[model samples]
Every structure is written in structure tokens, then in C-alpha cells.
Target chain A: MRLLSFILGRAAVALLTILVIVTAAFFLTRLAPGGPFDAEVDLDPLVRANLERTYGLDQPIGIQYRRYLGALAAGDLGPSTTYPDRGVSELIADGLPVSLRIGLAALAIATAAGMAAGIFAARNRNRPVDALVMGVASLGVALPAFVVAPFLTLLFGIYLSWLPVAGWGDGSLRHWVLPVVSLALPQVAAIARLTRGAMLETLSADFVRTARAKGLPERRVISAHVLPAAVLPVVSYLGPAIAGVLTGSVIVEQIFALPGLGRFFVQGAINRDYGLVLGIVILYASALILLNLLVDLAYGWLDPRTRTGR
Target chain B: MLLEVSGLRVAYPARGGEVAVVRGVDLAVAPGECLGIVGESGSGKSQTMLAILGLAGPGARVSGSAIFAGEELVGMPQSRLQGLRGDRIGLVFQDSITGLTPHMRIGDQLAEVLVVHRGASPGAARAEALQMLEVLQIPEPAYRLGQYPHELSGGMRQRVMIAMALLCRPALLIADEPTTALDTTVQAAILRSFAKLKAHAGTALVLISHDLGVVAGLADRVAVMYAGRIVESAPAEQLFATPRHPYTKGLLASMPRLDGPPGGPLPAIEGQPPDPAAVADTGCAFAPRCGIARPACMADLPQPAAVGPAHRVACHAVEPA
Candidate 1:
């Protein structure tokens, strides 16, 4: 019963958080010192009233909220007022694939790099190897994405001439390399530190000593006993790490010219496209909620101790 | 001879110079004979055994001779130690359940020692592993093969550990506090398995433990160490009956007895042994801890004086017992 209550509480928190963000996003975009439809020129008075009536913007705030909430209840996101003949739902559908592809590719890169570095650092302990890896990780974390994005674009995209500097190609595997690497750098460093710290603690545990005395090979002991146990903390941190990546990707998107949701959102902000801005904010928050849920599920699978104890 | 060490010295890096933990200790064991090394923590019993197998961690300073079946153990490379471990030199660790692999299937885990050292095929390893389980008398060996380490009881895991060790017919077996984690009944059974392993394979045994009762049951000869130096050596019965060294006498007296003395609890050893930093001097290491410490005892290191034909004690105060 307690476990059920705990899970329900988490779900309720997520729901309430999403509701508040969505509501605030709806009103804040309107109040952002600009108008959404100020694209070409000033509208005539009669035409502006017709536009207001068409989109139901002429209604009072409370009535408008009730109408929007009713549509939201039916899982309907209305047409984007900033873009003609484009539904908010359609805009989300179009952008989600790009965001997810980038997120997943970056997540994979981070996991591999972080786990390897962690295991290596742990195996080496306080040796020069550990010192070198941690030093590099520190540099990675300290450098902001704004600096890293430009640096990557200049180095790999210009001097090295390995990847395209400013464009994403035909949704192929190759196009993902630069964007994924840029987005994953800080997460990789963070995870490496997490893995190393957790593994160092586990390696000194009584169980590890017993395993060594049982005469397991150095490789097998590290992989089977230490690695699985160590990776758990990294799993728990996936939520915030992915959020950091998603938020970081927006800046990378601006630099790299990836036609992802981040690029769309940036353009919306510049043009004051209220509908587009609100839609993107909702998408971002929902993605965060979904990613965190997956991470929580993974924790239960990784360690049965938590599940049973709960 | 199955296992032998002559004047073995194991050192660790210290300030300016290396600190020798086991300084020139000599031991030899024949087939089917059990030898025990008794000492407090950090007395170098574990280190001495690790040095013999080349299992000491990095930067460890080791010297002297370790000859096992005419093969030199001292200065042996890491690759040689990898091959010898779980194969030529079987190890049964204390804390039985923890000693076994937690993530692995019990049978597959047992077979890993064979596969790693002997290059046994999976099927062959499994068969031999089950046979070993039978040897250790684990119940339902067939079904238990599919179960993991946590699935089994503590006694069963210890049995599996023994089975893994004995599978290769190792010439020498080392049990570092093998039964310390088990209950009284389980401990007896584990000790019985030790005898069976020794008998079946003609394997020599080196039991490193603090438990005198366990030592008395398992060891043919006992070497008593205090402050990283062996202070006395004797047959098990002789050591128990006539413990000549002052430290050895205190250790025996400290053991809880079924027959009690009225008016007071058992006497305690007054103080811990002296610091290891102060140990490698020209005098006895146990002299400060020895109740019968004389001026001569503190002035010069006492050589091993023969008490019985096979027994020796390193103290000037001790006469033939």
C-alpha cells in the first residue's frame, strides 16, 4: 500500500508540475511585451477584430482558460496562431522526432564514455591515469555549452574538416555525430565522476575483497561485480542529466543549424510567436517528465532491493 | 613436499626504506599435512601466504624462497600467479557467501575457476563442477546449478567455495578463516570437508586463522606469531599442552572453556603487541608483550630453539616443554 501511494504521489507531482508550467507558459507568452501576429505590418482595426474573433482571443482571460483547458482535456492543442494553417499538435509532432533522435544518440555516447572512464579511473585508483581522466572531466564540466558548441564547430567542423560546420543532413547516422558529441560532453563528464565515485566506494566494500580472495580474474571482477553496482547511481541521475542536455542542445542547435525543436523555439522567441513558444515549452516539460519516468523504471530493474523494500 | 617456504621475506614500501612484514619466516608442509599460522590482525600471516602465491598487491617487496613441487614461487611473474590461483593453489576464503560470486550461477561460478585456469570446455566444466558439488555434499546439485549465489544458504556457498578450490586437485590449499562466518554446526561440517579435500587429493593445507579450536581440529602443526614474527612452532597437541612462549600461553589461556574457574573470569593479555615500526630491531618483537620479558629478551632477538624434534619457540626464557 505504501509503495502504491509513493508511486501515485510521484505521478500526481508530475501532473501538477506540468499543469502549472503549461498554464504559466500560456499566459506569460501573451504578456511578454510583444504580440504574436506582429510579423509584416500594422493590422487595420476591423481586420484585427476579425482575427481576434476567429481565434477566440477577444474572450476574457477566465473564459479563454476554460476553453483551452477543455480542449487540452480532449488532448487537443489548437492551431498555431503565429503560423497559418498549422496546428500546435502538428508542430509538436514534426519537432519531436528530431529532438528524440538527438537525445537518444547523445545519451548513448555519454553512457559509453562515462562508463569506460569510470571503470578505468576506478581500476587505476589514485594513480596518474585517474588523475588525468578526472582533470579532463573537470575541464569538460567547467566549459559551458556556449563555449563548447563554438569550439567544436570551429575545430571538427572547420580545421579538421571532418564534419559539416553548420548543417544537419538527411536524417542519416553520420549527421548526428557532431551534435551528439557537443550535447553529451558535460553529461559524459558528470557521469564519469558519478561512476568513479560510486565504484571507488563499492570496490573498497567487504564484498569486493571477498570476490578477489575467491580468485576472480581482474577483468571479470570489475565488470560483473563492480560495474553493475556502480552504474546504478548514474541511472538515478539520468533525469537531470538529460534535462541538462536538452537545455544545452538549444544553444548547440542555434550554432549547428539543426532544424530541431530547439531551433524552432529560438526562432519563435525572436519573432515573439506566442503560440509557437508556448507549444515548445510544453513539449520540453513533457519530455523531461517522460525521461524521468523511464529512469525511475530503470532503477527498479537495476536493483531489486529497492523494489522489494518498497 | 607439497609446499615449502625457506627464509621468506615480504616487505611493503615505508618511509625512506621498505618495511618487511614477514621477515625470514620458514615453513614446509608435506602431502596430507595441515599447518596453521595463528596471529592477531596485521601479524603478516595473510601477507606471507599471498607472497607464496605471488598474490601480493602492486609495489609489495617480496624475497626468499617458496618452492612448491620444485617450482619457485618467489619472483614469479603475474601471469604465473594467475595460472596457479584456483588451480595449483586453491583458496577457500572466510565469509563464505560473500566469497562466492553474487551475480553468477553457482555451477557456472564453480566452473569459472576450471575454465579460467584449465581451459575446460563449458560442458566439461559444468560436469566437473557438479561432481565437485557432490564432493562437498551440496543438496540437489542438478537444480542448484541453475541457482545464483544468494539463492543458496551460507553453508552451501562455503561448500561451493571448497568445491571450486578442490576441483583442480591443487597440490596446496589455503583457507583464510574458512569457517569464521558460519554457525557452530556449519563450521564443523566445513572443517570436515577440509579433511576430505586433503585426503582425496593428497593436498597440503595452510590454515590462517585466529580461532584456536578451528586450528586444533585442522592443523597437524601450529606456528604462533605475534607482532609479525613467528614466536613458537609445534605439533598441535604439544602446543596446546605445553605452550612455552609467554604470548602463546596467554592465547591458550584466553580461549573460552567449558570447564570454568570460580571467583573470576579468564585473564586477559595486558596490552597489544608493540608497533610494527618498532618491530625489526635486534631484539624479540614479542618481548614487550611477553609477561616473562627479561633484560636479555629485550636486548637480542631470540633464535628458534627446539622444544620437540618438530617444535621450536623463539624465546630465551622458554625451555624444552
Candidate 2:
């Protein structure tokens, strides 16, 4: 009953937040000055007005919002004015999986490599090994995806004759490497720094002292007692880190010519495709809320203090 | 002796140079005997104990010999020391709040010591943990096994710590200020269990605390510490009755007396304890704060000299018996 209540409460809040996000996104995109057909030269004014009427852009802002919400209630995302042949829902369906694939890959790389480096630095603290790990993390954080992308592409794609430079592969591991690394490097550095700080604090806690006094080996003590407490901050940071990675992937996707949500969202914003832009915002917002919820649930499992109604 | 520590020292680095917190201290615990180590905070009573087990934090430099069952413990490898810890020599820390992992179930924490050291199957280890909790007289022992550390009260948590240490039936148990934070009633109950365990298991104990009253209830012999050194040591009764060292006298006088005036101001020691880094290398560490300090007291470091049978005091003020 307690768990159910907690879940219900979180779900209600998530719904309210997503509703607000959709409302604000709707108004902002509509208020922007431009039409989807403005980019096309030699278009007749009558044809443009006819296209705007078809996509409901000719209606008042309030009426369009009500219509959009009504359609959303019926599980419809409306049609893209720029991509007249494709509905917003269809565009999302096609684009989401690609973005999710790259985003998840980057997340995995960040978590594994960052956590390992953090743990290593904490264990060998104040040593040469500690300096080396922190140095690499600093470099990773300092270099953005745009700056690192070209260099990585130059080194691997052109110079070394390894890995593809541009365009998405047909799910090939080699093609996925550079983009995933570029997308994840900054986040990996951030996670590593957070983990290292948390790990240092956890290692010095009295419980960790007791764990050592219990005669458990150092490895068992770290894995069993220290890691859980240390990983908590890292888990909390993951929600925002994931959001930044996905949104940041817009530039990454454009540079690599990848068929992901980033590409569509950017193009939609440039063309002033209100439906497409609002639809992508809603998707990203929903993903962020769900990921944070998952992180909270994981926190409850990792720490008993946060367990609902315990 | 079940365990004997000779010239044990613990030092750590400071901004200027290395300073010894525990300077060449010596101690011994006989089989099934409870040896209480009494001192003020920063007197290195805890550090001395930690050094014996090789559990001192990084940058701490330990020397001298801790002979346990005829084996030197001071220079032992961590792998060897780990084998002895929780198996042959158990340790219980002061603060029950952080002694056990907050995220772990009580039974798992108890059983882990057995599983790791004795190679007991999980089933056997768990059964033994339950039995040990019952032995410690933890109410609803079976129910508590499933609960996390935070769910239990402070006294209950301390009992769990003791139970974990005693589960393996170790030859020696080092409890550093085990009952310091507990109320008198809870302290009594914990002491009763400690005495009972020692009687049944023949487990020698090193009970480190600043509370003389708590130590009086459980210790066979009491060692009084002052500024990282043992100032005096004797049978508990004798030490209380005829405390020779001035520091020991001060500690006893500071304790609230039941037979005295009902409402009198409790006495406190004057001057602050010296920081480890500020300790002088030439003379007694407590000489600065000593009430009966003479020119002789400052000339050289006082060594533990015999005062009576099995009684020794490190003070220039105490003449040879």
C-alpha cells in the first residue's frame, strides 16, 4: 500500500509537469514569427495561406491549443506542417529509437568508464595514478563534443584510417564508437568527478571503518559497503546528465548526419514547424521525468532511509 | 598472556613533521580476562588498539610488537591480519550508529563474518547469527535479523555490534568505548552480556573507554592513560582504591560520587589536552598539565616503574615501592 501510494504520487506530479511543458512549448512555438513555407522561394501567398489553414495555423492561438490538447487526449500528436506527408506521431516513432539507441549507448559508456576511473582515483588517492585519472577527467570535461568530434574524426576517420567519420552506420559497432565517445566524454568526466568525491566521503565514514574492522578484504569492503553509498550522488546526477547528452546530441547528430530526434528537432525549429517542435519537446520532457523517477526508485533501493513509509 | 603489546607506538604526519600519538605503550590481556583501558579523548587508547589489528588509517606509522598467541602482529601482512580479525580476534567500535552498515540487514551483517572467515555455508552462518543474537539477549532476535540497522534503537544497535563480534567466538575481543554513549541501564545490560560471553567462551577483552564507572563494572585489570601513554595499571579494585598517579587521581576525583554531597559542583581538569603535534620529545607529555610538577618531572620522560605487585605507574611523583 505504501509503495502504491508513493508511485501514484510521483505519477500525478509527472503528469502535471508534462502538461505544463506541453502548454508552454505550444505557446512558444506558435508565438515565434514565421511560417513553415517561408524557406521555399516562389511560393504563392494563396498556397501558403491554404497550407497554414490545413495545419490549423490559421486558427487563433487559444483554439489551436485546445485542439492540440484534445488531439493529444486521443493519442494523436497532430501533423507536421513542414513534412506535410508525415504526422508528428509517425516522425517521433521513426526518430525516437535512433536517438534512444545513441543516448543509451553514451549513457552506458559514461557510467562504466567514469565509475571505474572514479573508483581508481579514490583508491590510489594522492598518488601518481590519482593524478593521471583526474588529468584525463579534466581533459574530457574541458573538451566539448564539437571540438572533440572533429579531432576524433581526424585522428580515427582520416589519419589512422580507422572508424567512419560521417553518416550513421547500419548498426555497425565500428561506426558507433566515435559518435558515442564524443557524445559521452563530457558526461563521463562529470560523473567521474562526482563519483570520486562521493567515494572519498563514503570511504571515510564510520561504517566503512567498521567494515574494515570486520576483517572483510579491502575489495569486499569497497564493493559491499563503500560502492553503494558512493554511487548515490552519481545516480542523482545521471538524470540531468542524460538530458544534457540527448539535447547535446542535436549538434552531434547534425555533424554526423545521423537520423535521430536531434536532427528532426533542430530542423523543425529552423523551419518553424510548430507541431514537430512541440511534439519533440513533449517527448524529451517525458523522458527526463521518467528517467529521474527511475533514479529515485533506484535510490530507495540503494538507501533504506529513502524507502517509502518504511 | 592471550595477547601482549610491547613498546607499541602509532605516529602520523603533520604539517611540520611526524608526531607520535601513542608513544611506546605496552599492554597485555590474559585469557578470559577483561582489561579496561581508561583515558581522556586523544590519549591514544583507541589508536593503540587499532595498531594491534593493523587497522590504523593511511599515513599512520606503527612500530613495536603485538604478540598474539606467540605470533608477532605488528609487522604481519594484511592478508594474515585479516584472517585473524573477525575469526580469532573480534573488534567492536564505540558508536553503534555507524558501526553497522545502514543499508544491510542485521542478520546478513552478522553472518558475513562467519561466511568469510570460517567458510560456513550461508544457511549455517545465518542459523549461527540468529543464535548469537539470542545469546546477546536481543528481544525478537528472529525479527531483528530482517531489519536494517537504522530500524533498531541505539542500545539495540550496540547489542548487535557485540553479537557480530562474538559470533565467531574469538579468543580476544577489542571493544573501544562500547557503552560510552549508552545510558546507565543499557550499559549495565551490555556489561552483563559481555561478562556472560567471557565466562562461557573464554574470550579475553580489551575494553577501551574514558568512563571509569563503566570499566569498573567489567574490567579485571584497569590501565589509566594520559597523553598517549599508560600512566598507571593495576587490579580494578586496587586502582580505584589507591590510584597512585596524579592524573589517575584527577580522573577519579572528577567522577561524580554517590556518597558525597548531593549538590556540589563537579570538578573538571584544568588546561587543554596537548595536540599530538605539539607534544615535546624530551619529557613527560602530561608534565605541562601535571599538578605536582617538579623540576625532576621535566628532566626526562617518565618510564613505567613498579609501584606494587602487578602495579606500575609512569610518574616522577610516585616513589619506588
The candidate that wins on TM-score is 2
- Across residues A26-92, which tens digit of lDDT does each residue of candidate 2 receive? 8888678876878758688898788878888789989989999999989899999778899999999
**TM-score of each predicted structure versus truth:** 0.88, 0.98
Which residue pairs collide in model 2, if any? none
- Candidate 2's TM-score on the B chain: 0.98
Q: DockQ of each candidate's interface versus the true one?
A: 0.37, 0.79
lDDT against the true structure, per candidate, is: 0.81, 0.89
Off by over 4 Å in 2: A40-42
lDDT for model 2 comes to: 0.89
Q: List, residue by residue over A1-310, the lDDT tens digit for candidate 1.
A: 8667767888899889989998998887777876655657888879888887888878997788788878877888776776769887888788778878888888888989987898788779889999999999988889878888889888987899888877777877667778888899988998899889999987765556645555567787687777777788999988889899889888888878888888878888877766677778877898899789878878876654455541
> Candidate 1 lDDT, tens digit per residue, B260-318?
67567888888886666667668888777777888998789898889887889898997
